[model samples]
Target: MAVTGISANRLELLSIADAVAREKNIDREIVIDAIEEAIQKGAKSRYGAHHDIRAKIDHKTGELSLTRHTTIVADDWEPEDELEEFNDSAMVRLRDALKRDPEAEIGKEYIEVLPPFEFGRVQTQMARQVVTGKVREAERANQYEEFKDRVGEIVNGTVKRVEYGNTIVDLGRGEGIMRRDQSIPREVFNVGDRVRTYIYDVRPEAKGPQVMLSRAHPGFMAKLFSQEVPEVYDGVIEIRAAARDAGSRAKMAVLSNDSSIDPVGACVGMRGSRVQAVVAELQGEKIDIIPWVDDEPTFIVNALAPAEVSKVVLDEDADRVEVVVPDDQLSLAIGRRGQNVRLASQLTGWQIDIITEAQDSERRQKEFAERTGLFQEALDVDETIAQLLVTEGFATVEDLAYVEAYEVAEIEGFDEDTAEELQTRAREFLERQATELDNKRKALGVEDGVLEIEGVTPQMAVALGEGGVKTIEDLADLATDEIRGGHEIRGGERVKLAGVLESFNLSQEAAELLILRARVAAGWIDASELPQPEPEPEPEFEDVEGEDAFAREYDDAEGEVEAVEPEGDTDEPQDA
Candidate 1:
C-alpha cells in the first residue's frame, strides 16, 4: 500500500466522510457521497484495473474505505487495486498492504484496500485529485439538500454581483441565479442588495444545484401583500385577482366577505401605509386595487377606476364590449395612451373597444342598425302582427329546438302560409348563423381562453370586450338577440323590435352584445339576460257605479248585442 499526505488509522470510507462533514459544517452524507464519487474517479484514473471497485463511508462515525474487488473465477495477473502491474514481494507487500482476512475459500472473491506506505510523486498527485473531487461533490450535495424544498417559497439572499442586468445571488449554501428575464424591468439592482425573491425551481446541474429565482412572480407580490397587510393572512381581506405590468403597474381585485371591512381600505391602510410598503418592495410599482363585482359591467367600471363609463354596449354573441365615454373624458378613460384599458383587459381577460359618446351614438345609428331588427323600409300592421306571432314563441329560427309553429299559425292574428314562411326563414337564419360561427371559430383558432368566435361588429366586440367576454368561445352559448336588445323584452303593443332584430346583421347596439349573448346561451356564463316583466293587465269594470243600476241592466240584457255592445266598443278605453 502506498500513501501520500497524512496517515488515517482505521480510516474507513465513512470516517473520512464524517470528518469532512464536521470540518465543513455540511451533512455527513454529503461527505460520504463525495468519497464514493472520488473513489470511482480514482479507480477510473488507474485505467488498467480489471477488478470491480467500490468506496463507502460510515454515517454515525467518520470513517472512509476503498477497495478493489476481484472475481475468483478468473483472478488474472492484472493487479486488483490502483496499480495494474504486479511487483515482486519487496515492491508489493501483498499480504500486509492489502488487509486480507482469513475467510479462506478459494472460489470466493476478496475486496482489499491499500495500507499505509509511501507514495511516489505521481501517486501523491493522484491522492490530491481524489480528495479535491470528494470535496467538490460534498459541496454540491450540501447545496442540493439545502435548497430543494425551498422552490416556490420566498428566500432572502444578498446580491453578490450583477452582470448585464442579471443579478447573481449568494445564498449561503450555493449561488442562486436571478437572470434578467426573471427581474422586473427597469428596476436597478446592485451588489449587496438584500432582495427577497421567490425560488421558482431548483435543478441539479453540472457544477452545483441550480437555484432559479424570480422577483416578478405573482406569488412574490401576493406574499408581500400578505406581509404588509395583517388582514390578508387572517383571511379578513382576500385577493381575488391580480394583473401586473412587471415593474410599472399592477391591478388587483379584492373582496372582503365582512361588509364592514372594506377590502380596498384594508389594503391601503392608514395614510396609505400598508400598500406603500408593498410598493417599496416592488420598487415603487404603482398598484390599483378595485373591488370585485358580481356583475361584469359594474365590475368593469371598477376595473377601470377614475373613469366614468357613459354607456356600455355588450356584444353578447361575440363576448366583447364597447364602452363609450364623453369626448372630454376619453384620455382619462384610456389612461396614458391606453395603459388603463390594457391592464383592465389583462385583468378581466377581455378585449375592449372604447369610443367617445358621439362615435358610439353614430355607430349605433348607422352600422349597428341590423342589431335593432329593422331597416329604412317602414313597417306596417302585418309586419307588426308577424312580430307579435314570433313573440308568442312560434319563432322557428332553430325549429328543432321548439314545439308548435302550427299552433302559433292558428292564432287569430296569423295564417298558415305566413307561419310556414316564418318557420323556414327562422330555420335558414339559424343555419346561416351556425355556419358563420363555425367558420369564425376556425379562422380565429378558437381555443378556450384564447381566440374568440367571430361575428362581432367592431362596436359590439368593443362592448362585450369592455364587459369582459373576449372570444367566440365566450359568445357561442348566448342568445344572440339579448345583447342587441339592450335589456329590453320583445312583447309589447308598439314594442315590436322587428326592425331592430331584422335590419342590421348588427344588433341595435354592436357585435359585442351578440358575442356575449352567444356565450351565455352556450352555458359558459352564469349570467341571465331576461328582463323583468311589466305589470299585468287589469280586467275592465270591476267597480260598478250605483246610479242607473239594474233597470239599465235589464234593458241592456234584453237588447245587449245591438245597443250595448256597439256603444261599449266605441266608449271602451284601449291601448293605442
Candidate 2:
C-alpha cells in the first residue's frame, strides 16, 4: 500500500531537523542523515525484509517517502560461494562485472525492493526510538566539533551533573567533562553552579569528541589575569614568566613596558580587588605577582617572596647560585619544605645554595686572613706550610713522600731531616684529608657518569640525558628496541656532556660527585645505583665453632702438638 498520511510527519521532521540543527549548532544535512539512518533501522524492524532497506525525502516537493534497493538477477547465473545463484541474460550488467571477480555473478540477486506499508504499532514505537537516539548522538557530535578547536580557551559553564568525581558542565552548546584531575583540589560544585574553566583537551572518540575542561591548568591563571588586568589584554603589561603549584600557590613575574603603569599594582588592583577575584575562584589559592628584574640579585630577591634576601652570587659557568640571607631570616627564607627558595631557584634558573649571614661572614673572614696574613694567631702553620709546599712544586703528598733525602736538602735553611719532617707532615695531612674526603663522598652517595664510545648517536645521547637508568623503573620504561643497545652510565665519557666535567679537571674527585649527582637526579636509581652487593665469599668452614678437640687439624706427622683423630665409630667422613 502507498502511504499518504505523512504530510504532518514531514512537517514534524523538518521542524525537528531545524531545531536539532540549532541545538547542536550544526547544519541540516547531519540531522537528515540521522533521520535517514533511523528510518533504515525502522524499516528493517517493520518489514522483517531479507536485507536492510532505506528511506528518503523529496528534496523539492518536501514530501516524505521510502525506497528499497536490491540486486536484480536472472535464475541461471551462479555465484560460486553462495547457495543462491542468479546469473542469466535477463539480469543487467551484474554478470559482466562479475567475470572479473568469479566469486560474484552478474545475475546474483543481492536484494529485492519492497512496497512501503503503513507504519503500525511496533514499527512506530521503534522508529521513534531510533530517531530520538540518533538525533541526540548527532547533536553531541556537532557540539564536539563546535568546541574542539577552542581548546585552551576560557568559557563559563553551569554544573549540570556529577558522577564519579566528574562534573558535566552544560556550556549551553553541550556538556563538557571536567574530570577529577582537572578540578582544583577542595573546590566543589553543584547543579546550576556556573564556573569558568580552560578548555584543555578535546579527544574525538567513538561516542563523541570528549571535551576536557580544567580549572587547574596554567592557562587558567593567564586567563584569569587577562580578565582582571586590562593592561594584560591591551598588551601594556607583559607576563614574563609564570609558575604554578596548582591548588596551592602560583608565582608570576610581570614586566611593564608602559612605565606609567606599575605592573604589580595594576594586577593587584586598588584595594586588592583584581587579585582577590582570582583567589576566590581558586578557592583561596595564593597568588604572588612580582616585578621581574634583569639583574639576577634583584630577580632572586623578588623570586623569594615573603623572605628578604641579603645577597645573590651567581656562577654562570657552573650554573649555580649562592643566596645569602640574614641569620634571622635563614629558616624563613628556606620556608617549610624549602618551598620558598626552591621556587626561587626554579624561577631564577640556577641551582641555589642558601647561606646564612653567619656562614658567609665566617668564610669571608677566613679567605681575607689567608690572602693578607694580617692575623697569625688563627693561621695554622700546617695550612700555611701546605700552601707554601704546594707553591714550591711539591704538589701532592705522594710526591712529597717519594722525594729522596738528597732532594730535600736543596731548599735553603731546610736540611735533609727538616725537609724529611716537612714531607712526613705533608704526607700525614694528605692522608687524613683523603680519609675525610672519602667519608664525605660516602655521605653524599656518589653516582656514575656517562661514557663516550663509538657509534654513539644524538638520539642515544638525548635518551641518556633525559633518563639516568640507575633504577628498575627506568629500565622498565624503556622499549624493547631501546634496551637492545644497552644503557650508559651518567659520568661515562660519551654520555656526560663536555661542560659538566670542567669543574673536576683540577679536582678529579669533583667529577665523580657530578656523575653520581646526575644519576641521582635522573632517578635511575637511589644513591646506591648498583644492584645488591655480590655475596661475600663464603667463609671457609673453620674449626672454631663446636670444635672437637680430637677433630682439630694439626701437623701430626711432624710431631707437633696436634690433636689425634679417632677414626673408628665417631661421626667419621663418608669414604670416598
Q: Which candidate has the top score in TM-score?
A: 1
In TM-score terms, candidate 1 sits at 0.57
Count of clashing residue pairs in every prediction: 83, 21
Candidate 2 per-residue lDDT, tens place, 426-473, comes to 567666766665454334333222222222222333334444443323
> Looking at model 2, which ten-residue stretch has the lowest summed lDDT?
567-576
Q: On a 0 to 100 scale, what is the lDDT of residue 370 in model 1?
A: 39
> Per-residue lDDT for 1-576 in model 1, tens only?
233322363355456556777776677765556555554545545533444566555555444456666533322446678855643321323343345644433345556784333445554466567776767766787788888988867889899999887799987767898889889988787888898898888999987788998988767777788888988989888887777777887888888988999888888888888888888888888888887654555566567766766655455445576677789888987888678898887777667788998987796455334322331121222446545644443322343224466775776766877666655665565566666665554444443332333344433444454445555555554444544444454564345332223334553444445455565656666546623346989955544332211111122211221111111111110100
lDDT of 1: 0.61
The lDDT of each candidate is 0.61, 0.63
- In terms of lDDT, the best-performing candidate is 2
Residue 568 lDDT in model 1? 18
